[model samples]
Target: MTREQFIKRIAPIAVQLRAEGSPIFPSVRIAQSILETGGTINPWNNLVGYKVGGGAITPYWQGKSVRKLTWEVYDGTRQDRVPADFRAYDSIEDGYRDQDLLFEKDRYRRVREAENPEEQADMLYMSGYATDPNYAVKLKMLMASYGLGRYDEEAVQLRKEWQERLQQLEQRKQALQARLQTLRQALAMTEIPEWAKEAVERAVQSRLIDTPLNGSYDFYRLLTILKRRGVI
Candidate 1:
């Protein structure tokens, strides 16, 4: 697939991972996937070229794997392309998840804590995620060239919407509290109105009103007429 098509396919997954609180940044995730397969979507769904690494098989992996010739660098020495066992998955999403799970180790702490795509790419290299000396630079180049950071910006917007929703809920709660206070204060000021005062007083004397002051604001009009007509 073309580079843009590959990015389009993985962008949603990357953004969802970020929104779901994965420590990996979305831009870095997309760039890593693009770089791993050289901007082409692989059939095995091995987006990051992640190795089997002896990790216990789980839902994200299910013991599937593939072999590919890959490059490596050791102490500034570039090795020729060598055959390696790369993890495969049922879907690109699973591959992405497994890649994140690999970062759960203490050694990948810096990668997890990286604040941006650039830092994340560098930390991935510093954490020995890849043996390529220019791994970080290559990932950064892909991110910038493809505008992969837009996915991270989209995630930021999602968080902003949630924050705004929470603010609206807090405002509603404060309004409810104010309304309750008004009701409590209303009970104290519920004396009989001037128009109904005399009529209600007589009604109270006749025990027609069990609690004369407890009548609702609208009920006072009806109560006044009933008292005047001797209905009490």
Candidate 2:
């Protein structure tokens, strides 16, 4: 796929993940994805060349992996055609989530703690995330050329708005739940008033009401009046 298409597909998801508390910036994510995957999604959904390591399992990764020839640099020597087992995921989002989990490690703490995309990119290199000496430069170049940093701003605003919306919905939910609880308690009927006990019993026998005991005062009064009016 074209780079634009790749960005279009991945950027929104990366933005959402960032908004939802993934420490990785959208700019760094998109840049790394493009750099690693060449703007194309793999069938296994391993877009960032995340290799298998330490037998870690996340909700997003179920221990699936794929073998691929990868490049590596060591002590000023470059090595290519190195077959490696890269982690595979059920979906692109899953792949991103799994990669974000890797950033939780102590070794990658600096990468997560980086203040911005450029700093994060530099941290990724400094922390030995990639073997290439120019890994940070390449990432920064991609970010600059693609304007990926805009997503970070977008995510910040989106997260704020989402939190507000979530709070409103939560308040509404709590109100509804409390109302439901009150209604449930009301339905349980603590006592049937003496004035309406006979009417309530008759109504229950006639199958007009299921239980006569503990009917609310208003409910019992209504039933008695209705019975007197031959409406029950």
Candidate 3:
């Protein structure tokens, strides 16, 4: 996805996270997340430096990571292998979600122990969580450059606006959907063969059941809940 799409998708989650006392993540920190996750420029679409596998198990993932410990460049380069338990995701949004979950994990107690982004970045860098010596500095720089220092204030104002806009959008979308559904039901009520009605109903249900493509849900639940919900 494009950078704008990525930002729009993760912004709410980031704001909610900070609002819930998850450390005020600056816009820069979030952008840095994009960078680490293979931003729009890269194809990896990894939001966090989640490596495959190395004996560490993400509380959210029932299966082991793809690699034990893989090499990732910490100095703004994807080259050079570094020993880290990198997390992986199928989509950019899932990566961000995983990062949030990872931070909440007890293993990252030091990061949770930090009170601010600077300290958190430092702790994450120094504690072997990130290998780059300048990781903290870069994160701070990103924060400043993007004017993310005012994350909390911005989040509040934007959240209010977002709520208003979301309400309006939802209302509009619901109206449109209702009209479409009504039209479908009317059409179904009209002269139509049973086979054709079944086909249309199946098609609509199929669309409704489009499964959430992201990872994180346990495999069994992922199957059961999504399927039960009529999602793929």
Candidate 4:
């Protein structure tokens, strides 16, 4: 498959993983998967090239296994063809979830906390996640070339918008609190006017203001309170 096709197939999964609070950057994971799977139609649905060790498949792994000829770098220079056992999942989603499981390994724990895609890729290489010395470099190149970093950028944008919204809400809350304090101080006056006292009584009767009946009420608060109580 072409790079675009590969991205279209896996990008949603990458985004989903990120939304689910996966510690790994979505772009880094997508880049690594693209590199491992060769951007082809992965019928086996093994997105991350996960290997099955000599031990029996874990009880939780109900999927089949495929032995494929994989290339591994030996002596830090030479590539050797070796047949390795890889998991065969029923679907691409399963493969992606399995990839998340792989990252949970002790060696990959640090990579999960990496600050960015580059850092995560570097940590993966340093932790011997892959034998290729240029693995991190290749992943970085793919990320830059295909605009894979857009996913990270999108997440950052979402956080920024959320923060702005929260700030607005906090400002509104503060303003309301200040207004309520002013109303309380006014209501504590020794000689409240008859009209003001009547409004305060109405607000108290409607349960809009939890303050005592003798409490003061501002014009805005009085209108809102009456409107909320369906009294106006």
lDDT tens digits by residue: candidate 1, 1-232: 7878888888998888787778888899989887888888788999888999886886688887888888888778887878899887888889888888888999999999987889999999999989888899999998899888889999888877888999999999999999999876555547777888877777778887777776655667777888778787
Off by over 4 Å in 4: 54-60, 155-232
- Considering every candidate listed, which one attains the maximal lDDT? 2
Rank ordering of all candidates by TM-score, starting from the highest = 2, 1, 4, 3
* Winner of 2 and 4 under TM-score: 2
Better of 1 and 3 by lDDT: 1
Candidate 4 lDDT at 188 equals 65
* Model 3, runs deviating above 4 Å: 1-9, 20-29, 41-45, 54-86, 90-93, 105-107, 155-232
Give per-residue lDDT, candidate 2, residue 177: 100
Better of 1 and 4 by lDDT: 1
Clashing pairs in 1: none
lDDT digits (tens) for residues 1-232 of candidate 2: 7899999999999999999999899999999999998899999998888899886788999999999998899898999999999998889999999888888989998998898789999999998889999999999999999999899999999999999999999999999999998887767668666788778877987899886776665788889998899876
Q: Which candidate is the best by TM-score?
A: 2
Q: Estimate TM-scores for all models.
A: 0.70, 0.78, 0.49, 0.64
Ranking by lDDT: 2, 1, 4, 3
Q: What does the lDDT read for residue 114 in candidate 1?
A: 88
